[model samples]
Target: MAPNKDNLFGSKKEASLVKSNQLDSTVKEILASEQMNRERKTARLRELRLEKEALQPPPEPKAKAKRKTTKAQE
Candidate 1:
């Protein structure tokens, strides 16, 4: 009989650990990609807004009306 017989439960545990590690790495990668995508979208929106503003003409200044002064009677 061989003294170093492979245990089934030990192999299963090792496989489970490997799978968990892979899942964790995959989750991290997905989250990082999502963050990058959000940043890119935000930058694109900001650029569009700036471009639109540049294309529009500036608003004209409003003219102020002169008010008549009234004399107070003593």
Candidate 2:
């Protein structure tokens, strides 16, 4: 039987390719997890903010200050 060179201890190029694929998969999973966590936190914060705002009375509108008219010098 011929020795299987393609298994575990394959050529450098093959090993590198395998490692690259594994790294890519790992990085993709990490990014997805972070994104999901960020979204969940944002939603929770938004809900809390909405609840707080609803409980608070609406703010009264402030009156704009009238600007003093400058007299033209002759």
- lDDT per residue (tens digit) for residues 1-74 in model 2: 56786664589898799999999999999999999999999999999999999999999999999999999999
lDDT of each: 0.90, 0.94
- Compute the lDDT for candidate 1: 0.90
Stretches of candidate 2 above 4 Å error?
A: 1-8
Q: TM per model?
A: 0.62, 0.84
RMSD value for candidate 1: 4.6
Identify the runs in model 1 with alpha carbons over 4 angstroms from their true place: 1-10, 60-74
**Candidate 2, run of 10 with poorest lDDT:** 1-10
lDDT of 1 by residue, 1-74 (tens): 44453453457678899999999999999999999999999999999999999999998999998999999999
How high is the lDDT of residue 52 in model 2?
100
Q: Candidate 1, clashing residue pairs? A: none
Instruction: Choose the strongest candidate by lDDT.
Output: 2
